[model samples]
Target: MSGEKLSLKDLARKRDLLAPGHRLCAGCGAAIVARLVMKATRGPTIVACATGCLEVATTIFPYTAWRVPWIHSAFENVASTASGIEAGLKALKRAGKLKYDHVDVIAFGGDGATYDIGFQAISGAFERGHDILYVLYDNEAYMNTGIQRSGGTPKYASTTTSPAGKVIPGKLELKKPISHIMVAHRIPYVATASPAYPLDLMRKVRRGLEVEGPAFIHILAPCPRGWRFDPRYTIEMARLAVQTCVFPLWEAENGKYKLTGVSRSIARNPKMKKPVEEYLKRQGRFRHLFTPENRHLVDEIQKIVDEEWNWLLKMCQLS
Candidate 1:
């Protein structure tokens, strides 16, 4: 597969769509994800963001951080809202009332919205073939609502609702395979990315836009407060997730899969893969997994990660 075509030089020339003043935490990976995505877009664009950290932090009252046309949708209807927007644009174009030659319609939602609350909406939109790109900045938990557990949170990761106390060692269920779910939708494009790989992520964003039908990109966005990590390790957490094979970066175009970035390299050489512990130890949410009694849990988690990574590789191989 061809590597990420967009270079740092090309990206450096693009103006930042997201402004500097926002209420997101210091060293927030979601912010980086949004910025890189904005850089990838060149023409007229309209953004529809679900009610989450990005929406709340960036558009507080009269003040706004978004330089492009933006809309704020409810937690469970961003996809529906974007679908309506796309439909409206089509209608206007058919009537010869719209001025723009082309417009990119994108939706931004966090894990709570995308993986759970908004799943049905997204599924419907994709099935209806909306010309929109849906991006999920998965911080693993509902960080905007006091670090609550969500479908996107990995197993054994502690959250306020699923605390790592004496009886419970964090959440028991595995994280939902959302990217795979999107792929199953049979959309024109589906991808998994991380803010750590800006070139890879930006490339996927651009590719998703190029596709005619609905597209989805699931991005790992580390949260310092929610994940219990230092502010400086935001990007490190994103990188470690890919290196550990806990989150493999890949893209599926027209139902054909191909690994990308470090994940592609690691797929070629298994020796390049790091242990899942490297990723777990960095986050406070998984601190309990390192305990004497819970040590076996780490091995178990490693097994699952390995299995998932191999499954992804097989999909690409078969493709």
Candidate 2:
């Protein structure tokens, strides 16, 4: 995929490893992410998906959209399960009992499973240096379970667990810095991707998979029902996320960091970056922030975004 230009016609002609007919939402960014991710596999790939929208929808009853070997893992143990698979495959290959020469192992989990419930397991796998790539399709909440606020949820974004009202704002906490945490591990690769840029996302996936050691990609996926946006606006929302610096597109390879895609331009010229409100205004979850009384909350959130972006730029410059 190095020089291959990704277009609708070209992608349609390629064999999608995730296949079509999955029951994911019409504009679910996770589905698009999963499809593009699988297209970057270098060899026979095995996927271990945590119990979430991707696992539940893609594997209903006996029917499955996965055209490759797949495992349905419990929500909090996807990393552990993927680590076991990788270990088993290596053991078999060492004993000369396995037919396949190589198999790329990947673990899939939502934000709830990744940033919260499965955090410890993922940390263990990364520390152990397992040969696996963990793809986190973060829609910023536990959307599969009634849209409850997870650690990945942004501040003031209303969810079932954190409803905004005259009495209280939505979630009070900022999003967990999962990417930075993973980068601190000094892994082979750690990237933040968005479905808005398919080529960038696919290239990162390929890089993550091709790397020798543990790798992780945190993908910003948009959910139509959870975010209260039109189905057609999923890609638009993703693109705005980068342009607004609400979710920057970048990667850290072996403790070295660099901004990728449009984020690089935003770093050089701050004027090119759009206001964070441009991203927040698109989703109904952040609608209350537009109110006269709640307007200050938007400013507060913007301050955090600005600071985070500045910190990220400084971090990249250090390398």
Candidate 3:
């Protein structure tokens, strides 16, 4: 697809909607995801941002990073706030007072907000069929609050709340299947994406926005500080996540599953294996995963991921 129109590089060139001079960390995958999301949005888009790294980083004092119309709402209310915005826009359109022909509303929140505190509001928006896109940049914990464990934290991952102990290893429960829950809601569109694959992410973002009802794009953002990995390895870690089947790239439109991108070579070929250790060893969160008892936990994780991949691929085929 290199020389063809709408190539990956061409889509990647869609840039600078969120300008330079923003205060995100050097390897903040959330920043990359937000940039691509903004690029793919059609019509006049307004954003409702929740309290998190992105909000504090961008809207520091008089300095604002977003070029689009954006509002800062309470962390748990971003989805509700975006719904309000959509309603206002619809009211204006009906009254012939709206300046734009089509107005798109988006809500930005972290995993803490989406998977924990804000889940009910998000579900309400989905159930009510709001015309908006809610993007959850899943760094997998409450990074803004001292790396505390949130509902999205993976099984056996360490966090401030669920720290490694002689008795307790770390977060013990499996990461909540946020996307699958949304899919159960039967929203018109739902997707899992990553900043490492910008083209794929952008394509999914565009598709989500075009859907008539509520849509969601859950992005797996790797946090250098939270994960205890070198900032430079952010993109590499994200790519490995997909290659190892730890995070799959796929979408659902009108309840039809579609696996948009897959590292099939990694799945089919033996040489492509990168030990789950490689992905985990870099992260302090999984420090306990190296323990003898927890060593098998890593294998279990791999097994779960592989099984999910197989099931999802079959679902895609059936779709």
Q: Which one is best on TM-score?
A: 1
TM values, all candidates: 0.98, 0.97, 0.93
Give the candidates in order of TM-score, highest first: 1, 2, 3
Among residues 3 or more apart in sequence or in different chains, the pairs in candidate 2 whose N, CA or C atoms overlap within 3 Å are none
Q: What is the lDDT of residue 104 in candidate 1?
A: 90
Better of 1 and 2 by TM-score: 1
How well does candidate 1 match the true structure in TM-score terms?
0.98
Query: Which has the greatest lDDT?
Result: 1
Write the residue-wise lDDT of candidate 2 on 181-243 in tens digits. 999988989999999998889888888988888999999999999999999999999999999
- Give one digit per residue, the lDDT tens place, for model 1 in 149-243: 99999999999999999998999999999998999999999999999988899989999988898999999999999999999999999999999
Report clash pairs, candidate 1. none
Candidate 1 lDDT score relative to the true structure = 0.93
Q: List where candidate 3 sits over 4 angstroms from the true fold.
A: 1-15, 263-275
Tell me how many clashing residue pairs each candidate has.
0, 0, 0
RMSD vs true structure, all candidates: 1.5, 1.6, 2.7
* Consecutive 10-residue window with the lowest summed lDDT within model 3: 1-10
